[model samples]
Target: MIACLWARAASRKQRAGRESNREQLTAAGNGSAGPMSKKTLARPARGARGGTRRRHLTVLFTCVGRRVELIQAFRGSAERLDIDLTVVGADKSELAPALHLCDRRAVTPTVLDPGYVSALVEVVRSEGADLLIPLIDHELPVLSQARQRFEESGCLALISDPGVVSTCRDKIATYRHLKKHGIDTPRTWLLEAFAKRKSRSFPCFMKPRRGSASFGNYVIHDDEELHTLGRRVPEPIVQELVAGFEHTLDVYTGLDGIPRCVVPRRRLEVRWGEVSKGQVAKDPRLMEIGRRVAQSLPGCRGVITIQCIMSARGRIRVIEINPRFGGGAPLSILAGADLPGWIMRERLGEKPRIRMDGYTDGIRMLRFDQSVFLDRRGELL
Candidate 1:
């Protein structure tokens, strides 16, 4: 139904002339970047469907906090695809910086609130949102479970199924799932098991079993430190720490549960548990691991984030799995993965032209803070 509307609205063609069209993207995630084939044509979407009932594809983003880069990327990609995009920023606070610039702003209860789902459903209806993206890890479970509610409102929630989301939310579950499927992952244990076992190595790591963005994480060097910090962190789990260059794989998994693209970037610097400086590493081994990991994880939907550690000798160990877009996703987007654009194309009933390793390599992102200003009246200046 949405495809019909989108197709009808995109009756006009885009101006398609771009400099160094191939340079528009780096290589595919692991593939080489080169000139775009002039033989291929992008879909037409220059203007309204030659009619007056103008309807743009409305996308509602939950917890739209400090995601200005993403908002800009979506609008830019939409234009390239001839899509008229409308972004709705939904948050609990009226002061969210990203909210001020969205096509529409919706203030609602936090994800933990009992009324959150219903409020989101209402937002979907009122804003004519065809797509809903939950940005935070804490909201994954709730949004996945309530996906049906949004679907009833003719909106598709860009998340995995409830069970998939549940498994991804729990660190222990992710560890077990990866190990059970013959994937190389860091060894993990519950706090109780660590106490019973004496062979555990020192300098291990511990964090909340359900933690996100590396919060409440500790690096323990001995039993005393482990026991002391374990008591402080809620639902702590101990895991062997594989030290080396940390690499993040920004994977775009289609709604059909297949990975469309994977871009592995080595984290050069991390701030508040998010990547601050990073460069793409198109090592075949990393690319292969990403493919296997995505294939093993059942029901992965939309953008899937995988964190891994690679030793100097070239061994890679999986560390974390986030069933949503990562904070540094703009890097991949700018590198030419076109994750946002591909997602839009898929919903428009088009087969995305994706190369699993087609994104350019060595693309680096240096992220900095950008401020949004508003008057005391809470209106954009």
Candidate 2:
């Protein structure tokens, strides 16, 4: 049964791909980014023989936390354009309450268990979604699988192949792939095996090759620190820390395999595992690096971010590649650069004019409020 379903979904995806190609040609002919306005392409009333039916498009946004905040911001655009945006995550009930602040038409899918790619595909199919947009990093793998399995199922999953997704998922792998592709990246060494009592120099970072949110990351300033962290997490990599001003480069690539917009922001503060405060920077290196990376990952569809460092020597080194919508996406949206909407339009065969560096040229902080409570007691006498 599983095999049958997979086969069926694959067949559907191929058909959708063909249809998408035709739509792209039509959009190009009209010099528009998406379907024509309803008024311009009016259909006869229901039950009329020659009237074309308006296809209802379902856009699925999958993620957690602030990245999910984008669903609210883009709700109006989706509605005005006759697209339904469904937000899916592990906690539907938990997030459903918060979504009330946005368009009431949006819905949160009931994801009983997280990280199950097969289950996620099932939910997407049942929802009749036409597009699957992965908003969080962890969800990328599953989204990639859906793209492969359900290409023609009347839904479009904006993702690259699994091989590319896996290659981009790990920091160590990304470094190697970029280097192999002739793209300059930071020097990194994976510590697969290290004999005890083998002493080395200091000032290296020890963390998992596949990790985010600064989890399990430690800056070892000396030999003692290295040994201590080495004991904590085995088989860790040691790389030269690139110093100087660190910048987060948001690269929104269109369907033509070109970066339509690139926004570089200086990371001012980091709270928990996310960027809390940042500001747009007027650095040409940011755009250069973003373009280079985008060119390298031509198969990578949708939004991608690169965390880079500007060394004192004026050289830029890429720290990591995030292959999905970022947590700080709202900042770019506020600046008039809407990557998500652009992606939606592009997938539907519409070409959008992106205003590169559309955000304000100043500091902006994305802070989320957390509730703190105390127990009531009367023992103060």
Candidate 3:
């Protein structure tokens, strides 16, 4: 029966390929068939575990492009855990260190199909990925699917619940969920359509409900700017732009639902839509808030970076929560929290000792560009 099913699946794939070819030919001849819809772009879901799957620790990093800045940080952190790191991105060729860590310079195949869930499930089975950590928010859906399929397969997925991930990914839903849990967040409203019913005070932040890397984050000063921003991104959000220092509290929770280590850091500088330079700080308030937010979420495992803005009123308002290993994860490590090592130890049933010292203050980091050799000719040249 299994063999018959496999054969039928193969036959369907072959037929689909043939039909796709015919459509391609038709489009080529007509010159106006429009672009082909990327049905194959669906990310895959985790599959059922057929046998007793080997529990090899695999860390999956998902990204849209080659995130060179954070790749080095992740690679160095993963080395401390003594676990193989596999990065999954669209432009796999650009992930040099990740590919090197896997000991394969070639591009690892990606689940381009929107069926990313099924594609990832196949990968989990084939590559034996036990822990799937998302490096980018865009890959949240696939991670969500993995969590769902793991139950049926009895496979261990080191990820949060799908509903939680979805709710966190969408800022509107995240604010709602936090509010429902009595968590403090910046005053925000969803702008479904342009409405001048009431004018908000100037110096507000206009952002899309769903996005990453500050793709469309803008600060609108006046009503005119808000209107322009509303036209730019639909369903935009306008929040009171808090004035004060911004800080991120990077926290790691355990299986027992306790806050393991909360490392606070201040963003010194940012470039290309990423936090470049950061310094660790000992902030008790940040840690306290982080613990509360972590407990509020369901299936809260892995690393979460809580972004908070200190208001002029001397109050820290939660701005956003990234429920995954963030770009500045390494900074947390430097701050005396061995986050990567902690994750591995927890999964392996070993108790980890959390520490945060020597990072009280007076440490600064700056990201500067160094000269690079693009291409070179061989020996004599």
lDDT of 1: 0.77
Q: Which predicted model would earn the best lDDT?
A: 1
Flag the better candidate by lDDT, 1 or 3.
1
Off by over 4 Å in 1: 1-55
Question: Local distance difference test, per candidate?
Answer: 0.77, 0.59, 0.57
Leading candidate by TM-score = 1
Candidates 1 and 2 compared: the better one by lDDT is 1
What is candidate 3's TM-score against the reference?
0.72
Task: State the lDDT of candidate 2 residue by residue for 1-381, as single tens digits.
Answer: 122332333234324443443121111122233332221112211112223433244555554433434654455344445444443332244333222222111223433345345444444455445566666666676667667554544456766667667877787888888887776676777754332336544566677777777777888887677767867764577666767777888888764557778888778887765788877775777887888888788776777788888888888888888877677766666565667667655655556677766656664755666321223541111
Residue 131 displacement (Å), model 2:
1.4
Candidate 3 lDDT at 207 equals 84
Encode model 3's per-residue lDDT on 1-381: one tens digit a residue. 122332343234334434443221111122233332221112222211212333234444444344343444434545555444443322234433332223111233344555555544444444344445556676665666667574343234556667768887888888888888887787778764324546567787888888777778898877777777778875588776788777788878765646667777778777765677888767777777888888888677778778887665757778888777777766666544667666655654557776533244535555555221224431110
Q: Report how far off residue 374 is in candidate 3 (Å).
A: 8.5
- RMSDs, each prediction? 11.5, 13.1, 12.5
Each model's TM-score? 0.85, 0.72, 0.72
With candidate 3 superimposed using the best TM-score fit, by how many Å does residue 55's alpha carbon deviate from the native? 11
lDDT of 2: 0.59
